[model samples]
Structures are given as structure tokens and as C-alpha cells.
Target: MRLTNNLLFFFILILSLYSQPVQAQSCQELETWTRLVEHEFPSVESKSVRSGSLIYNSIRFNLLSDKYFIPVFGKPFEKVGKLKKFSIKVKLTKCKKKPKFPVSKRLDWYMWGVFSQERAYNDAVKEVVLLRQLRNELPSILTKINSPMVTNDDLEDFAKIVETKFQRLLPSEINKLEKAIEKQYTIASKNQLTLAINSLKKEEASFDKLMIISKFKTDNELLLKKLDQDTRHNFFKKLAYLKTKTISELVELEEMLLPNISAVTFQDYAAINTIIDRFTTNWYPYSNLPRVEKLRNYYFELKTLLIAVNHREVIQQIINTNTLQGFKNTQEAIFKYTFSSDQIILDIKSAIVLKYRQLQLLLRIASDEVQSKSYSMATRKKLLNSVKQIQKYERVSIEGKNLINRALHKSQVLCNYIMLEELKKITEPFLSIEKKTIGDLNRLKVKIIDFKNKYKTCDGEVYDGCIKAMEGIEKNYK
Candidate 1:
């Protein structure tokens, strides 16, 4: 009777534990970790986001689901030597229309992400990177990092690679945490990227459709909504296609009928020519015509501004000011990223970025000398640039050393000595590279310095030629 009672009590206890909600659990400590990085979703109520499709909305309580994306990590992720699965998520937001899922019957623009083995692994890596970055920078940013010699992105990328590799290896510490029998069932590493991006085709179609629909204003919106989903989708697609065709035809009509219809500003002329060029490469979607409206405004704005400024100065300002428009980096569907498996590439990339910063400094100084105008000064500045380049490579060796040291320090926190010792094997080849680079840099510096000291005023003829040209001009004038 006592054994039966005890067993009954145990069964009830297990059932109660299983039924407990995640929100009810003591998850405060786990929630405190802000290191988990994932795509930020837009406000759920926003018209743009409300219309997009969602894939993982139902998995909130599953133990293996992304609901637990936070500071608290499973021990299995860090202990496994071979990372069998890596997860990737792509989330897009604020879209034109929300399509019902099971993608085949869905309307345009709402893309559902299906699992790709490569995608999953890569997405997981993004978290690994974010965690590493926060580990290094959050502390430093709170205090101060004196003009960090390395770019934050470079160091963070390297740090993630190191941490991820260490995580992959079944370390002694993980073995200590889990018994051998339980290891078979534990899911250690997983990717938790939640991408909101639907389909590019659908997004483009909806945005186009909205523009065409807007011409009707409030009158037709209700009528359009009353149409069936497929009817509305086809109507929009056909309308957008016709709009694009009409614009192309109008451009041709103007060229044929009124090729010289009132001369335009130089700015307007240039912008028109650019539009012509765009027509060749662009898909000529309905959105393309709207871009020209802003550019034409620029033409008028420049013309209006020119009323106050001289043509020479205005032209100089326009020509000399190079506009390198910034673009968001197109992250790959799956980037060919180096995993924890290759430390050498990550190490080299970090060192190169640090050294590249030094080169940029030298270039800036050289640019300053160019603006000042002195032939001898220009040569001397360039010679100094060569010296800096040598010094930059010298620093590369130092950066490599620092990278190794940082890796060791971070590893020590999560791994036992035996696990770390195994990691050291991967880095052994990199040590020789560091030593070789340092030695070569030292030798090259001496040769470069000797060359700089030997550099003479070889630009004297340039000065003499300018003086002779000035005298000839005066003589001819007199």
C-alpha cells in the first residue's frame, strides 16, 4: 500500500511539472540575458506588418521551439563536437497584403520560409555572433575602449567563430552536466532566427498594386476589397503591368513627337538621361517612374539655388561633390561564412581589418597633402605612406596575437583545460603565420626606412617647368 501510494504521488508530480506554463516558471534569471540577437519584428498592429505571413506563431510553448531564445543556453549546444543542425530565419515586415499560408494558393508578396539545412546552420551562427559581440563590447561600451585598434565587426566575427567551435566540441564540462544515456535525447544546438521577409515577388506586386489603387482614392477601395482574393490579385497584377507599359509608351511618344520640348536644366537633362539608362537594366516595375519625380524636384531645387550662386562655382560644387549613396548590405540567402571549423580565416580577416584601418589613416594624410599643393611635399607624403604601410603589417602580427589571447580567455570561461587544449591544435598553424608576418614586417620596415631616407627632391623639374610657363605667359602678353 505504501509503494503504490508513493508511485501515484510521483506520477502526479511529473504530470504537474509538465503542465506548468513557461511564464509560470522561475525564468527571471534566464530572461535577464540580452545577448540573444534576432530579427526585430515590427509592431503587430502596423498595417504593413499585419498583412504579412507568419510561420512559427504556434510554437510558443514547445520545448524545442524558438520561444526560449535568450541568455539561458542548453548545455548540448556547447558540448557537441559536430554541429549537426544550424538554423536560419528570415523575417520581413510591413508588407502590402497578408496572404493565407500553404503558399501555393496564397496571393502575392507573403513568402513563407521553409527549412534549408544551410539556412538553419547560418541562422544559428548569427546568434553566436551577437552573443560574442555583446560579451566584448557591451562591457567596453559601458566603460570606455580607447580608440579600439580593431573594428567591432571584425573582432565580433572572430569571437563568434571561436565560441561557436568551442560550443560544437563535446567538452568535459558538458559531459559533467549530462549523463551518457540522456545525451541521446538532448537537443544541444539550434538556430532561432525568425525572418519576417515573405517573397520578393509578392512584396513588389503589392507595393505596385497599392500605387495604382491609390489613384482612385477612397472611392474604389471598398469595391476592391469586395473582390475575391484571386480576382483582386490578378486585377492588381494586370493593372500594374499596364501602368508600366503606358509609361514606357509615353516616353517613346514624347521622344518621337516633341524631342525638343523646351530645353531643361542641366540637372534635369542628366536625370532624364539616367532614367533612360535605368530603363535598359531595370525591370521597369510600376515603382520606377516615382523615382524620377524626386530627381526632377532636385533639378528645380538646383535651378532655384543657382539664382544666387555663380555658374562656375555651382558647377564646381556639383561636379566635385561625389555622392556615394549608402546601401544596406544584401545579406545572402546563405552566406558562404566560415564556421568554427576554420579559425585561420577568421583570424586572418580580423588582422586584415585592423591593418586596413591604418592604411586608411595614411590615405587621409596623403589626401590632405594633395589639397595643400606642393610637388616635393606630395612625394614626401607618399614616401611616408609607404612607411605606414610597413608599420601596418607589423601591427597585423600583434593583432593576430591579441586574437589568440582573446579566444583563450573567452574559452577558459566555458571550457575545461582539456577542451581548450584540444582547441589549441586548430590554432597551432596560425602561430607560425603570426611569427612569420611579424618577422617579415620588421625586415621590410628597415628597407622601407632606408628607401625613404634615400628619397630625393626628384620633383624639382616640375617646379622649374611651372615657373618657365608663367614667364612665357607674361612675355607673350607684354
Candidate 2:
């Protein structure tokens, strides 16, 4: 009895140790920020401590006064104060450590640093714009100084040099100057200059294929709505005509116009190419032209194609073939043609489905071997690792994760159904040899019925329920 008691005690101790939860490390930076906020904003009430499976390790706090709250990674915190009216301050330090100065003082120091840097950038932009305006007024200033007429050719040459020098500055630097000019003057040139600056910003943001696809679809829809059918058709026709025409002919036509025709229509021609690529690769072939069945279908196809080409194996293959060096040439030829986001998304979904099937295959093989007690440790490890890798690919936003989880559950249910059916098949032969073991049959019948009821609750079509049910059965049988 004492020996049994000691063994039981040991087992309980082991269980206790295993059940203890692991604590996440605190974020020193976030703690420091929190401390600073508490010190500076005494009236701001401290909220209840929020805990989850993942704890906040650290966070940077921008004290906008009365708006402070917990922040998750990658998400902007709630705005507490108006930027124009209020002076916002932030300070960073190691959590739980005593600083040389008060938190308020530290915050003030950092705020000054930030404000000074912003002032310096604004000052530089103002200087550039002032220089540009002075340069533009140079010919007039020179003529005024001489008190005689300056030749048009000399004035034009001086103006060209000034413009050339202005163009030499980076786009960002030019944008800064433009913003400074807009802030100082309320003229129409300011608005036009700001619009040009914003266009460059948009260009930088639209690099992602998904983002580009979304913008293209949005812009295309807007254009279609804005223009008449005849105008749209003519625009497309001109683009097609230009594609077939010689470069020299296009250049000659461009030269005939005061503002180059090519410059005005370049974006239109590029959009046409995108449309052509989408039709060819993503759209269903109808009379040798691409036709989309639905908007959703189009987006899905495009996303899928992009994901497929972006796969590690395909990228490695491209690198091995030394084709990546031709990126400059390929980018123009490939992306010149537009594809629908709907089509791309569809293609990505298709690839995911394929991956899901592969996982299912592995699961089935593993299950069969487990049932037979024939799978080696190495094989089991490999199967588990593959499942883990597939699970990583399944990671998305919380909503997306839920969808994937539902899909996995459905798959599991289907797997359980198959397993139960297989078990029934295997048991059929044993039934005739087991009049004495009728209790086993009764238990098996109860298990099967229980599984069916559980599956119904889980939406019988879902595989995850079936899988879970099958696992229960396996455990019970073992």
C-alpha cells in the first residue's frame, strides 16, 4: 500500500509541474513608456491589466493626454489629442530602472528633439523653394540691374539652367520644397505642385501586387464610369494601334504635338498592357480572347498566379537558371499587362487547396500506419513536421485564421468518417468470431453513434470534426 501511495504521489507531482503555465517575458521598453505616462499624466486613470495567451512585452506610448490605452503590435493606438493643437511627447527607457532625471523632463527633452528635427526639415524645404523662385526671377532681376532689354534667347538659356538644377534634386527633396511653397502661399501652383508630389508618394505605395491590383481595379472602374463607351473604346483602340506601330512613327507623331502625345498617353498604354495580360493568363478563353465569368473569379485567379510564382521552389529554380538577372527586362514585359485582383486571389486559394489536399494525404497515411502500428518514429516525425509547416502557411489575420480553422475542422470530420467506415470494415470479420465478446460490439456501436451525433453538431461536411471524433475513437480503442 505504501509503495502504491508513493507511486501515486510521484505521478501527481509530475502532473502538477506539467500543468504550471509558462510566463511571458515583460517588455522593458513598453514598461518604461507606461511608467513615463503614469508619471507625466497624473490625472489619467490606470486601466485594468489585460492578459492573454500572448502578453505585452513592451510598447512605445505617444501620450496625447487622456487617450492612453494598451496597444497591440503593428496597430496604431487610439488618438488622444489633436496634433495641431496639442504637443505630443514620447520617451523610451528600460522598464523598472530608475532614470537619472524625472520622466517628465526626459519626455520634454525627447519632444524638443523631435520638434527641432521637424523644424530643420521644414526650414531646408523653405530654403530650396526660396532659391528656386529667386532663380526663376533671375532674368528679370538681371534686366532690371542693366536697365536694358535682355535677349529672349539669353533669358531662355538662363531659365533652362535653373530648371535643370532644380530637377537634379531627389524627388523627396523636391516634394519637401513643394510642400513648403504650398504652406506659404495659397496659389493654384501650390495645389498643382502638391498634386504632383502626392503622385510620387502613391507610386511608392503601390509596389505590392495585391495593392497594385486593387488600385488598378478601382482606377479602371472610375475611368469607365467617367468616360463614355465610345471614348473608352477609342482610347483602347489607340493603345492597340500604338503597340503595333514602329517607335519612329510614334516618336514623329509625338513631336507634332506641342506637349508630346506619348507623355499624355503613356499611362493609358501601360494600363492597356495590364488589361491584355489579365485577359490572356487569368480570363477564360472565349474565341481566343479572355473573358471573366465574375469579378470574384478574376481577383482569385490573379492572386493565385502571383502566389504560385512567388513560391520558394519556383524562386529557387529561377535563381538556379540565372533568370533573376533579367528582372529589369522581365518586370516591364510581365507587369506591363494588368491582371484582376479577383483572379489573383482565386489562384492563391487554388494553391492553398492543393496544399490542404497534400496535408490530408499525409494525415491519412499517418493514421493508417498508426492503426496498424507499422509507422516508424522517423516517419511520424516527418508527418508531424509537414503538418506544422502547412499550419504556418495557414496563418493569416485573426479572421482568416478562423476561416482556416473551420476548413481544417471540416477536413477532420471527413477524415473521421472514413476512419470509422474503415474500422467497421475491419470489425466485420471479427464479429463472426466474437459471440463471447458481444460487449465489444455493443461498445463499438455506442462509439460510432456518438461520433455521428458529434459530427452532426460540427456540420457533417466539416472534416475537422470527423478527425477529432476519429482520434477519440482511436484513444478509446487503444
lDDT of 2 by residue, 353-408 (tens): 55445445444444544453432334444444444554566433344344345445
Alpha-carbon shift of residue 178 in model 1 (angstroms): 75
Q: What's the TM-score of every candidate structure?
A: 0.16, 0.18
Off by over 4 Å in 2: 1-250, 256-334, 337-403, 434-478
Best by lDDT: 2
Q: Write the per-residue lDDT of candidate 1 for residues 1-478, one digit (tens) a residue.
A: 9999999997886555444433212233222221111112223223343232331221111112223333233332223223111111111121112242212112112223322244543544454444444444433432222222323333345445434432322233223223321221111100000011112223433333444434632444544554556755655575556456545554554345333423444334444444444533333343256543443344334333322233333323332322212100111100111132334434433543454455454444444433534434344445454444545455434433443344333323222332233324323433345335555445444443433343322224433443344334334333
Candidate 2 all-Cα RMSD: 40.1
The TM-score measured for candidate 1 stands at 0.16
Judged by whole-model lDDT over C-alpha atoms, candidate 2 comes out at: 0.39
